[model samples]
Target: MTPTIPTRQPCPPGACICERERLVEIQGADLRILYLTRQEEKRLLDRLESLSSLSDLEHMQRRMFEQLGLRVTIVPSLNEVRSMRGIGINIDELPGLCRKTRQAIPAAIRRGLEKRPEIAYELLNANDLLRDA
Candidate 1:
């Protein structure tokens, strides 16, 4: 017998390639992976582990939003995320997580990047923010 797979609800109209506006964006001419929670981090990593190419990024994004079911959108830069309020990221714990994630992502991404280095170029920093408020 085959197990059934759950489908993610379609994103609301007007959001970009993502389910909402908080999934992807750009800042300072570079892409910033924003609004990541501890939850999203695990999902994203689970998806990443199954990928063999950079092209898989889109699927990673889609898979994540599908699991999350939020009003996500994928913009081009983090600057856009910076310009918004309640952008799905809870800034209250940002500074601390920024420090920890920066330090931890290197080791965490090392093995993954061994297969696909494009991710190295795409996000200089991927901060996993939580909105646990």
Candidate 2:
């Protein structure tokens, strides 16, 4: 058995923030992962409704492609991560890009303090969101 950590600090979403980017290079599938503080996460959802693209994964897909293997980014704003365009040389390098892309947001949200299933609809599944595929 292990002891539970006790602190006022909010728990992390405990997952990567996989927001796929636009089909910019078309080399291979691209993916971006990011880190966020709980405070930032809360503020993001609070201001979420203000963003039209917030609910649409397709619109955010472009960003994700650029953000593969990301670090030091905020979950809410997706700030401070380098783009994969420079890091990735070809499609094969982005192994499982599609799979990672799917788990990014919903998993992050699940680890969050609250999970909004209503607005989270688009965040749920790629089949439902990316119909053009």
Candidate 3:
């Protein structure tokens, strides 16, 4: 007995491509690999691993996108991710992380703007004004 394969849903009107599993394709300009999560990643990996030539990889990437219902997301620079590995923090922690980093900077350097001295003075006055009120 043979297992039945699922049929793809028709592409939505006004959209160039059908949405599959909420998948969208993002391609990195230089990277040869398709970087996606879960089953899509698995399908692409299996296809890539079996390829014996560069042309085969290129053809397979295109074919996989069409047949497997996977989408791509392009990374502008993979270089940006190189230093960010294993820092197990979620998206919500980023702003607080940025604030902590700002706080860690040397106070003198952070304050060293000759053109912005008036702004600094204004901030200082505002602190005192708030304290008095």
Candidate 4:
């Protein structure tokens, strides 16, 4: 089933495309891959960095997953996981993550997640992409 793309809010004439839609689409067959723009990424990283406890992170995680279908796992260190694996954010690297630009965070996330068929299936199913298949 083809996923329904969300409509973007109206922008002023002559506005840049980036200012119109904050979600960046990455091509894939099995999953609808979307990621935040640089500005949005920085905002998210800043918010994550400000969390004072694990509960706060968990709350944010749930909200993000439910709202945007983005999965983020908190890890003590980035070295504990493979770079090309899941979207695991090292709590220690929040500042660095915020500094990454030119869609670097989103690109890394797409690379890490695109390889996992199960994740694709799960996300697709959750979004009801499989309902009419």
Per model, state how many residue pairs clash.
13, 13, 10, 0
The 10 consecutive residues of candidate 2 with the worst lDDT sum are 80-89
The Cα RMSD of model 1 versus the native structure comes to: 16.1
Residue-by-residue lDDT tens digits, candidate 2, 51-117: 3333443333344345444221223212321222111112223322233423334344333313343
**What's the CA error at residue 24 for candidate 3, in Å?**
16
- Regions more than 4 Å wrong, model 4: 1-35, 75-133
Better of 2 and 4 by TM-score: 4
Residue 74 deviation, candidate 3, in Å?
7.8
lDDT of 1 by residue, 1-133 (tens): 9975432333446532442233223234211234455555566555555556544644654654454332223222434333223122211222112333333333333455545655534432333332221
Q: How many backbone clashes does candidate 2 have?
A: 13
TM-score of 1: 0.28
Better candidate number, 2 or 3, judged by TM-score:
3
Q: Which candidate should be chosen as best, given lDDT against the real structure? A: 4
User: Per-residue alpha-carbon lDDT of model 4 for 56-107, expressed as tens digits?
Assistant: 5467778766654555654322233233343334322111122233245444
- In order of appearance, the predictions have TM-scores of 0.28, 0.23, 0.25, 0.34
- Model 3 residue 92 CA deviation (Å) reads 22
**Between the candidate structures 1 and 4, which one is better when assessed by lDDT?**
4
The C-alpha local distance difference test score for the whole of candidate 4 amounts to 0.43
